[model samples]
Target: MLSTLQPLLGLGVILGLAWLASERRRAVSLRLVLAGLALQIGLALLLLKLPFAQAVFLSMTDLVLAVQRATQAGTELVFGFLGGGAAPFETRYPQNSFVLAFQALPLILVMSALSALLFYWRVLPLLVHGFAWLLRRTMGTGGALGLGAAANVFVGMTEAPLLIRPYLAGLSRSALFALMTCGMATVAGTVMVLYAGILSDTVPNAMGHILTASLISAPAALMIAGVLVPEHPDAADRAIVAIPSTSRSSMDAITRGTLDAIPLWLNILAMLIVMVALVSLVNQMLGLLPTVAGEPLTAQRLLGWVMAPVAWLIGIPWSEAQVAGSLMGIKTILNELIAYLELAGTASAELSERSRLIMTYALCGFANLGSLGIMIGGLGAMAPERRDEIVALGLKSILAGTMATLSTGAVVALIL
Candidate 1:
């Protein structure tokens, strides 16, 4: 009884706080808060607590594990002899240091190739179309907007634009915003694997939680984006957004997807390399800052301080709020990948259960600066005419996307 009632109490608190913050816009604020609560229960029952859902969730984990294992064969074949036979979970040891997120960045190329092959084989398009169908019906969106949003859940922001290539010129401003926000708000299927590997040990069901966060946030993204900047007049007036392209052939898909994954893989590699270097530099520079007691303030420390208020706003306990705030800041400014990496690096067993659960949902999406650039570039490329609109809307979209993820966090906080 207490376990069940605790979530409801949390929900009530979140709704009350959000309502107070937007007291002037009480009606809209209340609705958004309620929508978040609804999502929390829906996800908890259907995806987290249900047996069939658990089965499906585990399948994703297995599928990811297989892909990671198979794709890393070359690396493993060469290096496995040195330490491959070691404990499978040894990767969790901070001392192991070498992470597969960078190690398997190349698989982006492989998966892209596979995606292309699936497109060519017509399998990918059908999967995309089917999901698009759900979005259209569930969100009252046109086929094009639905496909674009669904694509973001699976592919990178830029790659997702390819699915709606033909319809870009026809979309209304609102639909276009939804498309970009979706990209900013969800992880691609490929990196989903990377995060799964990163947090699998620490969080037993990390994959399921990450997948659920992405899926639930789709509608939340649409809701927030539409509110931020209403859909273009033309789009609101249209019956359906047009779908783009016939399915590609298998051979052509393999060739194309591999080519497509190149930039994605490089981006991943570059992000990790640059971010790691940057963090190291920051640590060194912070060494000179005034020491508090024996420890000088650092970026993570400052971010923790700045975000602690926001973390509390989300209803995390005061003791853990600073840590949660730091996670939120890292995820927004840099990327969730780093946030998860750091979260896992911490002695999480020492963290309160509520903090662990909240971080799980909070760091679950792609709501970061990198993804903003991603949405701008991806959508801009799709409809060069809308380049200005995409750029102008970037900040607003980021705010909405951030809120969309928070809406998910708010939901998770309730359930926790």
Candidate 2:
């Protein structure tokens, strides 16, 4: 019974944390908060527990796999053996031959191009509108805020705001916070397949879980944002916004998408190199310190100590909390890509299946410092007059975003 009740405890704690961070505590709508939590729980049960929903998401994994294969085709043609092509020389350790930059990272390019093509064809807009409608009806979000939140599920944070570009200047503090929180709390579709590929060996139906995490986190984000910056009763905006496609044609969409992905691809590649090197350097410097429990005091260990309680609060078992916490810390401090890579590197024995599942949801967000800068820069460009306000709310959104993903983990823990 104690074990069964732990998740409920965690869920309450997660909600309480958001409540504590609320800017106007008295103004928070009990109805909206409860509705958002119910929606999150309901969606989790529908997507994760129902057999038909499971089958649908499982089927979607095949498309992810297909994209991987197609990406490999392009990579192989461009990079030859470096990109998973037939090598002239035999390697003593075949398992170590997979080059992440050449093989796995290319999936981002493929996914971006495919998403662009779908958007141009109006396929993605239909899905976005459906989700927007659901948010509008259930959460009482305005048209622009709901659409921006929904778009974040399919596109990057900066790109999501573009869908509601005209209304950025006029959005209320609460609505703007909701948009930023949703974007940071959820992962974009462009890198979803790449993440699935990385975790395929570790998590069952990896693509499905990643997709579901993003979907569920949307409501969680809005919920937390509403709490952090409660909308004034008289200030609510309920106008319905139209979804616009910027692509002129299918081919143009693909080309633009591919071009858009180049900078992101480079950014990811550079981040991996720099972050890994910096961590190694820090660890080497810390090696001079006295060992803790006969273990070297390194960055991961430090992070683990800091975030262990948070991991446990999300229903990760104590035994595995340190490792899980370290991943959470890496994700928050560095980025989710690094966190996922670290998770992939960890052995199964170190983290139980349940702990891994919880972490998958917990770590599936763009709430790191790097992304905060990107959000400010992108949104700032759109509304220069409100740049100061954007900056002020930016830091708080990180906390709100982190709480959003953690709340999803808590709900998953409750039902799993």
Candidate 3:
């Protein structure tokens, strides 16, 4: 009974927090908020439980796995032992020998190129528009905002706004906030396979869960954005935003996509190196502090204590809440990649199935501090006039995105 009730507790806490932070608290639409929550829960049930949908998602996961294996083959041929090929010299920690830069980062390049081909073929735009139409009809979001929000599921924050560049200058504050918040709440599909590769061993249907998180985050983001920045009655209506599949040719699409992915790849590689070393340095300093519970006080443990209530609110078991909290804190402070790598590294037997599921849902986002700068730069580049607004709302968007993903975990716990 307590288990069943915990998710409700989580739901209440999430809603209460959103309401408290609302710009015009009394004016927020309760009906629309409830509808958004229902949409998230319904999509999860359909994708995870229904026969046809489940099979379709599972097939996609199979395709992703195949792509991963293909990437590994290429990695082995090119880099040898560093890329998980047989090493010439024996090394300590053989598992660590498969460096992320060589094995996982290459997947980003492959996915970006493949996505470009799909876009050039008009397949991706068709899907993005269909999803955007649903958001407009169901949530009353403007066409420009709806399209931008849906596009974020497939592209990065910066790339998505480029799709609706003409409309950005005229978007209402509420709509702009929705666009930014959605960007933080979801990861681009180009990197979904990379994340799935990291969790292949521990999580069943890795691609399926990643896809579901992106889909579920759309409405969840809309709900939070609506509350945080309520639309003005006099706001301008957005023109029909075109979803263009632009490329000179198929070969051009491949080249352009591959080139576009380079910056992202470098960013990920540099961040992992610097952030991990910085964290290690901090932990070393923290180790000098007085012991707690007979264990030296460390950064992860400190985060665990600070974020434990949030973990428990999201239906994590009290016994494992500290571990779960630490993961959440890491995702927020550093980034989702580090958090997921840690989660993937943890002993499977230590965390229950329910706890693992909740953790996956909670950690699936791009809401860290680094992303805030990315969003500002991306959107600010598209609409220079609104640069100040973008910078001002940066922190608020992070909070909304964080709550959006947590709402997903809370809903999953309630239903399953």
For TM-score, the strongest prediction is 3
lDDT of 3: 0.77
| Candidate 1 per-residue lDDT over residues 249-349, each given as its tens digit | 56765676666555555554554465557665876798787897688766666766787766665556667777788787788767788888887878375
Clashes of each: 7, 0, 0
Please give, for residues 1-416, the per-residue lDDT of candidate 2 as tens digits. Answer: 65457667877887787788788899888878988899899989999987688567556556555666788899999999999899989888886887977986676576667777876786665555565566657886666788778767766686667555556787888998889999899987757887898999999988888888988899899999998899986555633344456889889988977786676566656645655567568879999999989998877668768888888887888888888888878887678988998888863459988888888999999987767766776677667788899889987888888888988988888888
Give candidate 3's TM-score: 0.75
| Top candidate (lDDT) | 2
What lDDT does each candidate get?
Answer: 0.63, 0.79, 0.77
lDDT of 3 by residue, 102-154 (tens): 87667766666777777788766565556557655677666667777876776
Sort the predicted structures by TM-score, highest score first. 3, 2, 1
Output the lDDT of residue 197, model 2: 88
Q: lDDT (0-100) at residue 400 of candidate 3?
A: 93
* Every candidate's CA RMSD: 5.8, 4.9, 4.8
Off by over 4 Å in 2: 54-136, 238-303
- By summed lDDT, the worst window of 10 consecutive residues in model 2 runs over 234-243
